[model samples]
Structures are given as C-alpha cells and as structure tokens.
Target: MLTLIELVGIFFFAVSGSLMAARRGFDMLGSAFLGGVTGLGGGVVRDLILNQSPATFAHPVYFLPPVLAALCVYAFTPAVQKLHRLVQIFDAAGLGLFCMTGTMKALENDVNPVTAVLLGVITGVGGGMLRDVISNVTPDLFNPRDVYALPAILGATATAFAWHFDVLNIAVGTGIAGLTFVLRLASIRFGWSVPLAAGHWHRQPNIPNHGDGPRRNF
Candidate 1:
C-alpha cells in the first residue's frame, strides 16, 4: 500500500509535469526531461539531504511514469489539453502525498520532528522549484503572491507531530494529505493569496502557483 501510494503520487506529478511541458510548446525531449524532473525531483533532494541513495537511481520505474506521461501528451495533444485542466488538482495531490511520505520517511530515519517537517516540505515542493528554474522563470514558491508552501508546511507539521507523538500512521498521513489538498484547491477557487513586499512584489499573472507546481504557461 505504501509503495502504491508513492507511485500514485509520482503519477500525479508526472501528469502535471508533462501537461506543463506540452503547454510550453516543448518537444518530446523537453517533455520527458521536465516530466521526470517534476516527478522525482523532490524525492531526489530528500534522499540527498538524508545522505541516502536516490530512489530514482535504484528504482528505474520511478522514471517510467514521467516518460509515459510525456509521450501520451505528445501523441494526444487535444486530449491532453483537456486533461490539463486538472493540473492544479494533480499538483496539489502530489504535494500532499509527498509531504506525507517524506515526513514519514524522515521520522523513520530518526530525524528530529522539527527538521523532519522541514524536510517534508522540501521533498514536497523541491521538484516544482526545479521545474520552474529549468524553464527559466521564477517559481511560485519565491513569489510571495502565492500560497503553496503553507499547505505543505501544515501537512508536514501534522505528519511530524503525529510521528513524534507515536500516532503517525497511514490514517493520520492521509488526513493531513487531504487537509493540504483541500486547502490548496480552496485557495485556487477562492483567490486566496499572500501579500508580497512592495517594489519586489509583482504577481506573475500568467502562471498562478497551483501549490508547488507549474502553471498553464510557465
């Protein structure tokens, strides 16, 4: 069940990644590259910080969903276009799932609760950060105009707290994930936003941060 949950998270992120790549007018190579980066980038960073081998290096299956998602988008542009509308949900799902999984893993590895929560947030959002950076655009993460990291941090905090208190399990994690997911989608539906500093605060109207994922354009 754990492995399946992780794979579901990977697949959701892959869909968002590939959909973003297609919308970017990228070719197959670009689609695949971005897809993979978005799919596993967070876990890669998490593993690195934990001083463990990247699961991507040992589990090639992790790469499959991104490539497959890219191919599907490339071959079925119109159909994929329809699917793109759900990209926000996909991103939210991935963010929530990874936050849960990352926190659990960190706790299992003996990381302290506070630091584990931080790692969980990083593991959940790092891929989207990499994706935007590679695309040569500022990510919503740094954009104070966005509200992504909040849900992730909340979920991670919940997960870490549960673990430290000996109550962390699939149920707790799932609830936290759901909390993150709902909050993110609500932010999108309700135009929830955080204020940025003056002069440095410019909203990137083109791409709203769908919670640690790419927008329709960048």
Candidate 2:
C-alpha cells in the first residue's frame, strides 16, 4: 500500500512539474528533469536524513514513473491543459500521501515524534522547493502568502499524535491523509495564509557576500 501510494504521488507530482516546465517554455529534457526532481527530491532528502538509500535509487520503478509521466505530459499538452483542475486535485493527493508516508518511514526508523513530523513536512514540500529552485523562482513555502506547508504540518502532527494514541492504524492513517488533502484544497480555494505583521520583518544576521550592498528587501 505504501509503495503504491508513493508511486501515485510521484506520477502526479511529475505531471505537475512537467506542466510547469512547459509553461516556462522548457525543452523536453528540461521538462523531464523537472518532473524527476519534483517526484524524487523530497524522498531523497527523507532517506538521507534517515541514513537510508534513496528510494528512487533503490527502486527502479520509482525513477521511471516520473520520466514516463513527463513524456506523457509532453505528448498530451492540450489534454493536460484542459484538465488543470484535475492535475491540482492529484497534486494535493500526492502532498497528503507523501506527508503520511514520510512520517511512517520516520517512525519505522525510530525517529522521535517531533523529528518525524518535521521530516513529513520536508518530504511533502522538498520536491516542490527543488523544482522552484531549479526554475529560478522563490519557493512557494518561503512565500508567507502561500499555503504550501501548513497542510503537511497539520497532517504530520495529526499522524504522530494519533499514533501515540494507538488510533491511527492503516485506516486512520488514510483518513488523516484525506483530511490533509481537503485542507490543502480548501486553503487554495480560500487563499489562507500564515499571519504576518505588515511592518514587522526579520533580517538575516550574517551576510553571505560583504561586497554586495546591504539587502534592502526583507
């Protein structure tokens, strides 16, 4: 079940990545690269933190699905564009599944609850972050106006808490995943955002390049 869910999530994320790449006028190779990174980057980070081989490297299918998804997206651009809403729906599903799966893997590795929850959020958002970075865009999660990380955090927390209560077995885990999906979708629909003060901003303590002038924007 876990493997199946992971594959489904990878496929959808790959499709979304492909779409984004196409929208940006990337070549086929660039689209494929984006798809692969969006599908596997998060899993790679999760595995590394857990001191395990990255799943995409360990499992051949894990690597192929994203490539295949990119090819399909390229071949069916019109169809994919027409089904943008469906793509978003699947993306939300992938986010929820990845969060739960990451949490479960952390638990299997005997990680503490806090670490597991954090890992779950990382696994859910890391791929998209990689995608954005590669595309030279600010990651959506870093944009306080975006609803990228909150759903994953909430879902991971619920999973960890439920496990502690011995309530989130397989069925309950699925429920939590579903709830996370719904919450993410609703956030998109409602434009939910983290609270931020209009005049309050935090500045970095250290500057990476002294030759560069002081940063003006917060």
Candidate 3:
C-alpha cells in the first residue's frame, strides 16, 4: 500500500515537472532530468535523513515514472499546456500523498510525532523547491502569497495524530490526504494565502530625529 501510494505521488510530481520543462522549452534530456528530480528528490532527502538508502535507487522501477512523464509531455506539449488546471490538481494530489507517506514512514521508523510531521512537510515540498530552484523560478514554498505549505502541514499533522492514536490505516490515510488535496485546490481556486512578510503588513516606526536625515525605505 505504501509503495503504491508513493509511486502515484511520484508520477504526479513527475508530470508537474515535465509540464514546467515543456513550458520553458527544455529539450528531452532536461525535461527528463527535471521530472526525475521533482519525482524523487524529496524521498531521497527523507531517506538520507533517516539513514536509509534512497528508494529510487533501491527500486529500479521507481525511475520509470519521470521518464514516462517527460516523454508524454514532449509528445503532447500543446495539449498538456492547455491542461494547466489539471496539472495543478495533480500537483496538489502529489503534495497530499507525499506528506502522508512521509509521515507514515517516519512513524514506522520509530520517529517522534513532531519529527514525523516535519519530515512529512519536507517530503511534500522539497521536490517542488528543488524543481523551482533548478528551473530558476521562485519556489512555491517561499511564495508568501501561496498556501502551498499549509495544506501539507495539515495533512502531516493529521497523519501523525492518527498514528499516535493507533488509528492510522489505508482508508483513514486516504481520506486525510484527500482533504489535504482539496484544501490545496481550494486555496488556489479562492486565492487563499498566507500573510506576506511581517514588514509588508506592519510599518516600521519612524526613526527619531537623532537618526540620519530623512528616513529612507530600508
């Protein structure tokens, strides 16, 4: 069950990366690379932190999804580009699934609940961060106007809570992940967002006259 969930998440993430590469006019090799990184980077980071071998290396089949995703994007670039809404939906699904899987894996490894939730959020957002950085775009996580990380945090926290109470199972996990996915989509659809930097909200107090001449924007 866990493996299946992870693979589905990977495929969705790979599709998102492939779409980005296609939008940027990347060649086949670049598309494949971006897709692979977006699909597997987060899990690799999680495994390394847990002192386990990365699953993408351990299971050769894990490499197939990104390659397949890239090929599909390359073949149908126009159609795929026109389906931007669908891509966002898949990305949200990937975000929810990865966070749930990451939390479950951490708990399975005997990690504390708090750490598990943290790892879950990392697993949810890390791949997208790497993809954005490599593609020279701003990461969604760092985009103050996006609610990307909040859904993942909620999903991870729910997973950890369920696990702690000995009530986590495939069904409950799926429901929680679905809720997370919905939250993400709703945020995008409704323009829901976290507040921007504190400075953006609150004005700095005026400096005293003893300060240098006219106060300038910092």
Per-residue error for 72 in candidate 3, Å, reads 2.1
User: By summed lDDT, which 10 consecutive residues of candidate 2 come out lowest?
Assistant: 79-88
User: What residue pairs clash in candidate 1, if any at all?
Assistant: none
State the C-alpha lDDT per candidate. 0.81, 0.83, 0.88
The reply for model 3, stretches above 4 Å from the true place, is 79-84, 199-201, 204-218
TM-score of each: 0.82, 0.83, 0.89
Per-candidate clashes come to: 0, 0, 0
- Model 3 collision count: 0
**Candidate 1 per-residue lDDT over residues 1-218, each given as its tens digit:** 65677777877787777777877777889989888898799998999999999978998878888888788777766655565456677789999998888888888899988889999999889888887787676785787556888889999999888877888777877899899999978887887777666444454455456698655544
**Which of candidates 2 and 3 is the stronger one according to TM-score?**
3
RMSD, every candidate, angstroms:
9.0, 5.6, 3.4
Residue 105 of model 1, lDDT score: 82
Instruction: Give the per-residue Cα lDDT of candidate 2 at 167.
Output: 87
- Cα lDDT tens digits for candidate 3, 70-176: 99877776664465675577679889999999999999999999999999999999888898899898887888777999999999999999998999998999999
Worst 10 residues of 3 by lDDT: 78-87
Clashing pairs in 3: none
Question: Would you list the clashing residue pairs of candidate 2?
Answer: none
Ranking by lDDT: 3, 2, 1
Question: 2 or 3: which has the higher lDDT?
Answer: 3
